[model samples]
Target: MLVAAAVCPCPPLLVPAVAAGAASELADARTACSDALAVLAASRPDRLVVIGPAEEGARGVHPAGAAGSFAGFGVDLTVRLGSGPGGERALPASLAVGAWLLDHTDWADAPIEGLGVGTELQPARCAEAGREIGASAERVALLVMGDGSACRTVKAPGYLDERAEGFDAAVGHALGTADPAALLALDPELAQALQAAGRAPWQVLAGAAEGTGLEGRLLYEDAPYGVGYFVAAWS
Candidate 1:
């Protein structure tokens, strides 16, 4: 069962080196992420699983100590999921960002692993994956990483979409309230249309927390660089 969970945005920009001169723009979100990690530490979980959206090549399990680098983003920084045996597969960008967050927070409370869900994965599969993760240990914690709508502004990655605001609002509410049903109810078609990368992973979180009865708090919510970023903690 899930003892605690933290929802965070997966933008590489969250890393100061990746963001370069623009790093300060995400200072508040970074602080909130640190606080959320503290909540996970307090839970004293037996295992920690990081979930994030990934491309086809990066989808699937990434073991603890799996290596990932920001070189693809023009940075030479490298990160590991946690201290453990290394794996052959590299961490996806989303999971890499998750790893970066773990490192930044100095997480050492439990064994760490990662799962990279494909963006096109169906809700049912995502939920099943989550259920498996929740059952993997006695007390499980999750660090979910993904972004909301990228169509908040005309200059956004997906360009302006009239439905973006409403979509993000509902997502914020669901995450803030720990409403699994609400998260599961999100329209995949609509989410894809709005380029909401968080849809699949958030649904996975919903599945994992099905009967955990965790309470939630919204740590932060914002649209920076035309992308919706959110941080929430459940424990």
Candidate 2:
């Protein structure tokens, strides 16, 4: 069996909207996550894991309650990081979305696991985990959440400056700003590097709200600040 995992960064504010926006733009993200999960589940792999930040803070990580599950989607169980705070045990928004997907799908009754540890969201650690999980499964897909900057920070070998530039450009276009050139003036070196990486800024920007099919303006208008960097990848 092949197992696939997708990771996405999520802020705390969107938690309430999972059920509230069952039919809105937020549903786009939900569908994307569920699609990935369904793919993994269909592969019938040994395990399918989804990684993300803690919802409340960045101290620890944990899984969501049983109320969350994705039925027909390809998830047998969900393992979440514990709370990042002192002693609070809460899952991150990314993982919460995963759990919620599982709950909403046919696999709602599937077993969900929680893995809590005090660790930083570094690339080495995440990659290491990805490798470990991959080793055990016949086939693996990893969807990393977050944009170039966030992914670069966590994934190590930081993203090339070119990628960052592309992201900035996309952001500028999405924002309808006439002078994204100012970004170049502010961070010339970074801009040059992003340009060199050959990264697709528009793709990174689009990925955030890819499944939603909503225009960038509408999604960005409602998304919380700093949420744009959240990304997902499969390996």
Candidate 3:
């Protein structure tokens, strides 16, 4: 069962070094993420699992001490998932972003693990993975990282799509209310069409929280850089 869960966007821009001049624009997002992590700590969970969308066929389980670096994004900054047995396995971008969040929050109470789910994964499989995660440890907590839609504005990465706004709205509502059914019911086809990276991982969250009755609060929602980023907490 999930004792607590924090949902965050996995943008490289979340890191000040990576964002550079644009860093100030995401100040509120940073604060919201910090507050969400604080909420996770308050739950006193013994373990935390970080889930994020990854490349096609790149389903990897990263250990707590797995390293992550932003050099590929033009930054040399590096972060660790937690304190597992140190290894050379570098985390994928999504898991790297999640690792960066854990490091930034100075998480220490529990060991942290990361799961990278392929973006195109079927909802059923994603949910099953989530169920496994929730059952991995007693008093487990989760940090789900993925972006909403990337086609909100005309300048958006995927270009403006008329359906983007409505899609993001429903996602926002579902996440804010901790509606598992809504999340589970999210259409993968529509999400892919809208370039919503959060679909699969959010389904994983839905699986973990099914029947848990967790109350949710939307911490933040914005479209900085034309991509929908959201932060929420379920407890």
Candidate with the greatest TM-score versus the true structure: 1
For model 1, how does the per-residue alpha-carbon lDDT over 81-198 read when each residue is reduced to its tens digit? 9888969989999999989888878566699999888777888888888888899899999999989999999999999999999999999999999998899888999998998999
Q: CA lDDT of each candidate?
A: 0.92, 0.35, 0.88
C-alpha TM-score for every candidate:
0.98, 0.45, 0.96
Candidate 3 per-residue lDDT over residues 1-235, each given as its tens digit: 7989999998998888999999999989989999898888888898898889887544678877888889999998888888878465678788888877777785656988888888888889888988888887788899999999999999999999988988899999999999989998889999999899999999999999987899999999999878899999999
Instruction: For candidate 3, give the lDDT of residue 164.
Output: 90
Q: Which stretches of candidate 1 lie over 4 Å from their true place?
A: none
Ranking by TM-score: 1, 3, 2
**Residue pairs with clashing backbones, model 3:** 64-82, 65-84
Cα TM-score of candidate 3: 0.96
Model 1's number of clashes is: 0
For every candidate in turn, the CA RMSD to the true structure comes to: 0.9, 12.5, 1.2
Q: State the lDDT at 174 in candidate 3.
A: 95
